[model samples]
Target: MAHLGESIDVDNIVPERGDFEALPAGPYMVQITDSDVAETKAGTGLILKLTMEVMDGPFANRKLWTNLNFRNPNATAQRIAQEQIKQICDAVGFQGQLTDSEVLHFRPMRVQLVVKRDEQYGDRNEVKKYSALNGSAPPANKPQPQPAAQKPASSAAQRPASGGQTRPWGNRAA
Candidate 1:
């Protein structure tokens, strides 16, 4: 891939059809029709068009996905390999083989072909982080809720030196 400016690591990967436990329904292709990226940003991005039917396991599948950016886009095959593993596993789903790309038994499917992973590999924690900050409530161990909302001092309390319409507190106009 060519050089591109900084990119957001959505942390979601579109999996290949074969990865699903069941055959993809049909007419499946990952695509990125529209992007929020600015025109000034150089280089292009890969938007997948994964057909939902492709993964025909069961229930109406609804989930979110994302991918982290490569630490070093240029040079460094090891990093490339790591990101590829991250991509493949993330797309197809990996259990973090404890070797960072180790072939995953990936529960349910348990495909033999998988990448081993290191302890810190395939950060499943990214999702957790997203939820922690952006998601709803934080961990129970987290700090307690702070104070409640309070309105600014009512301007009605203070009439500037300049004369202004004034009304008695809680007074009703009959």
Candidate 2:
């Protein structure tokens, strides 16, 4: 049990309200405030989850989440994940490997958000594309074909190799 130090005035107190509506889908400047890698629930693949915070405009302070499955057996999924990660690295001028522990909050990047809907899960925001910030040239909408000898930054060895447990959002299919 705890005791109150002073008498509280319940009549004058008001509860703070929070907005639950999702931000309208569009291109927004965001900073990666947090990131982590985790295995899928079935223990078959790994996913990188990035928590991004909107840096400016009307949606400032809002949070957006994105997941990239870089270790999946499916080739197409792997390719898509690699492309997204590469776009991010290039946008922020990061070269070489990327790890879950690396600090990615220094610079903000532009990301186009789209709403994804599932019969059972309803609708949620998904990162449809990533681009360089203002004053920088935007990347091609589609990844240009690369030679087999020249590997992209998101190559298997350069991705997050391991983590302790599965992430809550990582279980969803890519």
Candidate with maximal TM-score: 2
Lowest summed-lDDT stretch of 10 residues in model 1?
125-134
**CA lDDT, candidate 2, residue 89:** 72
Residue 19, model 1, lDDT: 34
Give per-residue CA lDDT, model 2, range 1-174, as digits (tens): 678988899999977533334567889999888888999777888898888999999888888888898889888988999899888876764544455435355467898888776667567788888777974643322234568777666754433334544333222111
Q: Lowest-lDDT window of 10 residues in candidate 2? A: 165-174
Q: After superposition on all CA atoms, what RMSD does each candidate show versus the true structure?
A: 22.8, 11.5
Model 1 TM-score relative to the real fold: 0.18
lDDT of each: 0.29, 0.71
